[model samples]
Structures are given as structure tokens and as C-alpha cells.
Target: MAQLSTEVYWHSTEPTEVGPPLDGDASCDVCIVGAGYTGLWAAHFLKQAEPGMSVRVVEAKFAGEGASGMNAGFVQMTAGKVLRRMLWYYGAEKAGGVYRAVARSILEIGRFCRQNGIDAQYENTGILQVATDTKQLARLELQIKRAQRAGVTSFRLLDREQAQERIGSPTVLGALKVSGALLNPYRLVRGLARVVQEQGVLLHEQTPAQTIEKVDGKWRITTPHGTITANEVIVATEAMQGAFPELYARQMPVWNYLLVTEPLTDEQLGRVPWPGREGVANSLSFSTAARLTADNRVLWAGGLWYMFGNRDTDPRHRRNDDAFDKLGASFREFFPQWRDVRFSHGNGGLISWSHSFIPQFGRTDSGMVYGHGYTGSGIAASHTGGKILRDLVLRRKTEFTELAFVTVNQPKFLPAPFGDKGGEFFIWRQRVGDRLPLLLPYKSALAPNRFFARRTGSPERATAGRSSD
Candidate 1:
């Protein structure tokens, strides 16, 4: 096998045009931190809602340099395990409402790409959630039950034969076919940056927000090069939330790794027989996700590693050999027919994770508006979050702002040492449960309790439907 290059495959898809950083003290009606999907989408919707509003976005690096560019490109509806928790906490109505919004966002994303002439390689191919063992199958069945209770019918169950016909994986005992897509996330975010820029939003790349404060009924954000003052600010930094004092306890950054192989030969593709070319993920907490690039290279990503006190910003952790080796082994196991396929790229990045596994979108005590904590499943959800941020900033009680995730108080992780130990335990337990399901089932020890069963009223259920576009 060839040595893996420690570079993100998606970054090479196109040349990045870095915008000029904040030159001096600047002020806008709204200032956004982090130019990833959440921040950029917020800017997009904000401009659409109020065309005259002055919006500015600042990024530590170029756009999509964080999780937006580093993810496995699964435009999926799955928000980690948040849907299940939402069902437990807020019941079917609110949970279903949120799910439908995100589901719509997926189609809207494709539509936006087409309308804006952004070739993000958006494909409407549904995602396949496969089960390799009985425990995982049980998990999928449970998910289907919850989805049904939440008025979702698009998650169709497929037996082993049917699942194999879609993915050609021998280990797939059964699968849940859901509406989603696989696209180049970096391309999408960069395209979004361009669109927002054209809409008169100011984008400053290579400018990191170092200090944020609310003073005299206005928000102030200080970057390395300059300062920005605004009537409202959106802190959309996902994985880097740990850097901020107020957000540090609310989310922890966990390192997730990915490996991509060179383009497969036609014979190799023929051997796999994946006609749908859908993104596939196993039914595990720390599940492996695989997708095909436009160029036919196989991209595989999984494995979660958390550093003590959320030290994921360290550049050294971006290249994890153990994680890459395990991912390569998993690829061979899933596709033994292509056992000789060698990975060309391997990279790792941080994912902002909340304790509840659901995204938290609201303002802080300091009154700075923010939206983040997608838990590694933000592609489509961030679009929904963008609308919510717009509504929040505009002080409008739209359906987006009244969603359960926005209204309910989010659970917080323990501070510092405790959080680090708690995160480590969670990762270890989930991995063990995934590997040894018979011995240690997932919900056996980590089941939700009565404390999280409060029912918050939500908007009417979204119509029972599936993605058409």
C-alpha cells in the first residue's frame, strides 16, 4: 500500500480564492464568525431577508477550511443521534417538524447550486444505513420505529439482498434507505461564499475572531488584524467553539479522520456493482461512512478521537496514523473485492459535539446570537440553522425560531477535566458497543432517562413525505 498523503482530498478539487482579511476597524449591521456552512448560509439568508443589512463574515483560514471542507460529503438528514433524543425530549411533533425542515434543506441545497451555477457535484442519491450484525439491525429497526412515530416514511427498510443490490456489501444484513446526497462539501461552501459575496456580504478570510464582547447594546468582535462592531453577531464557529469562553463548555471538539483512494479502474467498479453510488454508513455510533467522488475515488471516513480539554486545534492531530490504518482496514473489510485499492489521501479534523447530540441554536447570556453544534452532521442542518439565525437576528418568531432545538435549553458538558474524561469515556464506550454489540449493546448503559422526557409543544408535523428532487 502507498503511504497516505496528509492532505484533504476535497481541498484539491479547485483553487481557493482567499478574500482579503479585515484591514482595519469595521462595523456592520451583522458580523459573523467562522466562514463555514453555518456562517456563510446565515449571511446568504440574512441578505435575502434584508437586502440592505450590512453583513460581514470573518474566517481564520479560507472558507470551508474546517469541518465544512473536511467532512465525508454525506448531505444526510441524520444529525448524529439527535433525532432519537429529540423524539424522547420533545416528542414526535417537534422532532418531526425539525426533521422535515432539514430534509427540505437538502433539496433546497441542490436547487441553490443549480440556480447559482455552482457545480458542487450535488447528487440526490439517497443514503444507505447498513447493518452488519444483529445488534446493528436492531438499532436500525428502532430508528425506523422512531422515524415512523415522527411521521417520516422515507426511511424504507431493505433486506440483505435488496441492500446488497444497492451497495454490493456482503456484510449488510439490512439497511434503511433515506433521502440524502453525496457532494463535494468544499465546493459547495466555496460556491456559497461567492454567492453571498455577490449579494453584498463582506467576507474576510485569514482573520480569526480573538475576542467577542457585548457593549452599549452592540456586539464587538476583535480579530487579529482589526475590530468589527455590529448590532448583532453570529458565532458560527463549530469545531472551534472551544476557543471561546462562553461556548467552551457547551461543545467539545472531537477529531474525525478520512481516507480517500485513487480513482478506481472500470474493472474494479464493475466488480463492486454499486449502481446507485449512494453514500453508505453502518448503524454504529462511530460508524464508517463511504461515498464515491465525481472522479470515482472512494472516500471513507470514521473513527472519533477527543483530545484532553478539547485541544483539537493543534495542527499535529490532523494526521492520525492509527485512525487512517483502521479506516483502510475497514474499507478492505467492507469491500474485499477491492482489497488491493490503496488510499491516496488521509486527513483528520475536529467536529463540534454537544452532549445532547442535537444542535443548539440561540443567544448567549451576553446576547451574542449563535448557531452551531451539529455533531458532525451539519451539511443540511446548517441550512435550516441559517434560517433560524436570520429569524433570531431579525427578532421574528418564525417557524425556524420556534423549533424545539431552538426553544429548549441544551445540556452542557462538564467543565475541563471532567468533560475531557467524560468525552473519552463516551468515545470508548460507543466504540466498544459498536465492535462488541452482543457483549455491550449501545443503549444498555447510555439510555435516556426521565429527566430528558419533557414535552415541548412544536409546530404542526411536516407532511408525511419523501424527497422528490
Candidate 2:
């Protein structure tokens, strides 16, 4: 199949446009360059933490127009990280601390919405990570143990039978259920913009940064219509950091796409069961992620994802459509019963990738406090990143420096140009354990992409997807 090519997702149908462009020189204590959750939240919390500080946001397109708006909307609690990685990255205890920071972000989001009077269809129904085979089940077991040690209160292990009953899918051999929330990412972004505006933060949309420089010992971020002179500049544009090359080298881009089925009839809905409205991902991790929306549609995504905003750059958006179709067809083979269901929308967007495939945060040599490279797992991490960046500028301690960035000796990401063949091959090796049952057991270093086999029917449950925050 042609590899998936965009990250714009479920809420792609939601309307959007560049906010009014910058008109002239703007001065602020802190200037955020992207309006996605990270930038907006930075503005909001900064105002909360220090109300007098001037804050401004500038976006190439509208808020949520990037990964934040184009994801499966799964708010990953720290409860979702692989146990071994935590052990390796932070040596168990510290890893748990990182996880705690992520877990707390869920509550932070709710508080942000309620306090701001922005209703983004936030539902605290939790999430499910299912393993479709013995190997995957074993991986789930490690995750369960790790979560327990990390002090996570809401993670539970489900065996094959119990998992099947809980998810209404017999293909699942194991699952990890934990506390999380579902959201209309589009609504969430809109709500954030509204709140940030109310808090007195200026927003500049459709204003791409032509150049960023430091003049007279201050940071100057310039666009076509205006410039932002601030004590500090926050580069929250996770994937599209085209304005800075240092960022591009540290954070790479990959393609992922999502499609939603027409609202499932009460009849079809009955056949598929979930506990309230939980988000879902697969245990194998070939980058598939899915979620239940505020509406009844099931939104799903996978593969080489990219985003060309406004769907204006190219019609057919052929690459993403094929990825969506692959996911749809895979879903059909797993549950032939849903084949006739109509699809109301098909869309794609971008997910940021760090050199280490880990989300990163902190300052740069250019005096630009940077926070990009989510590598598709931004949801809760984004919130934490914002807080960390805020602290960095304010001269406070942050865990950002401690988190391990995806680097050399780690799985060398496939070189560009090989495309799908290389991607699928890499995926297959990492995931073989999941698809092959007990053959290889599990390893934090064990890649899960090799296991992308069999319909398993349920794609999202096997791997958590990316987000804009």
C-alpha cells in the first residue's frame, strides 16, 4: 500500500482558517510561536502563574490546524508508557516520576477547561491498550507491572477472555486499561484560543516566521506583517519547525492519517462495546491509534503522516486516503459486519518525531526556548513540556533535561527515500513479537513494528497515536 501521508485527523472536518495576521511590532514578556495546546497552554498557565507578564501566540495557520487538531484525541496518561523504557530511561523510580507528571496532566486539562469555561467535550472515560497475541500479551504484562511500581492508581490487566468481553473483540489476547479522557481536539483548541484571548494573550495566525533573530540582546521573531520582541521565545510548533533548522535536525517529520466512519447506527454501535467513551490503541506499537468521538463515529489512524493545511495544497490527498482505506479495509476484515457502514469524513495531518523518537523540551543556543519533537506521543507530554519550558524561562527546575532523547545506538530510524518498504520492514521487525505470540517474549529494546500482521481487527488498541498538545 502507498504509505500513509498526513496527520490531520478526526476533527479535520471542523472548520478552521488562519487567525488575523500580525499587523505590526508586538512586545511581550514571552512570545509563543504556535497556538496548539502547548503554546496556548503555555500562554494560559503563564498568565495564571504570573498574570502581569505579556504573552503572544503566532501560528502559521489557525490553532489546532496542525497535529493538535489532527489526532485520534487520546489523552495518554503516563499509565501508557512501556515499562522497560521507563526503567532504562529513568531507572525505575525517576521513570515513575515522569509518568506521574504525565498522569497529572489529565487533571490539569480538565481544570484548564472548566476554569476557562471552554467545553471541549472532555470525557474522563479512560483508555484501553490491547495485545492481540501471546507476545503482545506478555508485553502488556510488563506494562502492568511497571505501572504498578510507578504508583499509577488506574491501570488494570485484562486477560484474553476478559479483554474480549470488555472490548467486544475476540482478537485481543490482552489489554491495559487506564484512566484517561476523550476530547474533540478541534473543540479543545477553540476553547484554548478563547481562554487565552480572554486572558489577554494576542494571537497571530497565518503568519509564518520568515526569520528569527536576536538583536540588542533580545529575541526578535519576525513574520510578514509583524515582529515579536520578547524576553523569551517559545517554539511550540512541534512538527512544522521549518523556521529553524537546528529544530529540524533534532525533530523529524513522519506521515500518519485518520478516517472516521459515519455515525454508527444504534444497531452497529451495540455490536461494538466500550466502557463509556474510552480512547484505544494497540499493544504492538506500529503507530496505529483510534478513539470514540463526542459523536458516535470511530476515528482511526496509521502510517507515514503529513499535514498540508486547508486541504488546499493538493486534492485527492491520495497518500493519506490510501492509508485511511488500508485501516478501513483492515477493520472490515476483522469485523466483516461493518463493511457496509458509510464514512462521513476522511482526513490527515502531521505528528512530530524527535531524533530519539521521544518528545523533547528545553532551550536552544539561539536563545529560543524550544519544545518540539513529540514523535507522535504528545497528548499529556505536551502539557508537561509547556510547564517545563515555562520553568526554564523562569529559571526553575525541570525534568526535561533528564528524559532520554531518541539517539544513536537506539533503533536507527530508516533513512529517508526508502519510504513504505523501509517503513514496513522496520515496523515488521519491531512488531513481530506482538503478532507471533510467545516466540520472542519482550524487551524495552525490542522493536514492536515487526508485529503489524493479521487483521487483529482492532488497530488502535495495539499502538498509541500522536497528538498536537
Residue 466 displacement in candidate 2 (angstroms): 23
Candidate 1: residue 394 Cα off by (Å): 0.4
* Local lDDT at 169 for model 1: 81
Writing each residue's lDDT as its tens digit, candidate 2 over 252-339 gives 5555666676678788888866655566677655645566676687776663344333212332443455566677875665446677
Candidate 1, TM-score vs. the true structure?
A: 0.92
User: What is the per-residue lDDT of model 1 for residues 1-469, given as tens digits with 9 covering 90 to 100?
Assistant: 3488887899999798788999999999999999999999999999999999999999999999999988988887754255688888778898888888898899999999999999999999888888787777667646766777888755455666667888998887766678898899999999999999999999999999999988899889998898999999999999787778888888888888899999999988998868989998887778888899999999998855656454547868888787888888888999999898888999988888878788889988888787878888899999999999999999989999989779877888888688888888888887777767354444412332211122112231112237311
Q: RMSD (Cα, Å) of candidate 2? A: 7.0
Leading candidate by TM-score: 1
- The residue pairs that clash in candidate 1, if any, are none
RMSD of 1: 6.3
lDDT per prediction?
0.83, 0.65
Clashes per model (N, Cα, C within 3 A): 0, 42
TM-score, cand. 2? 0.82
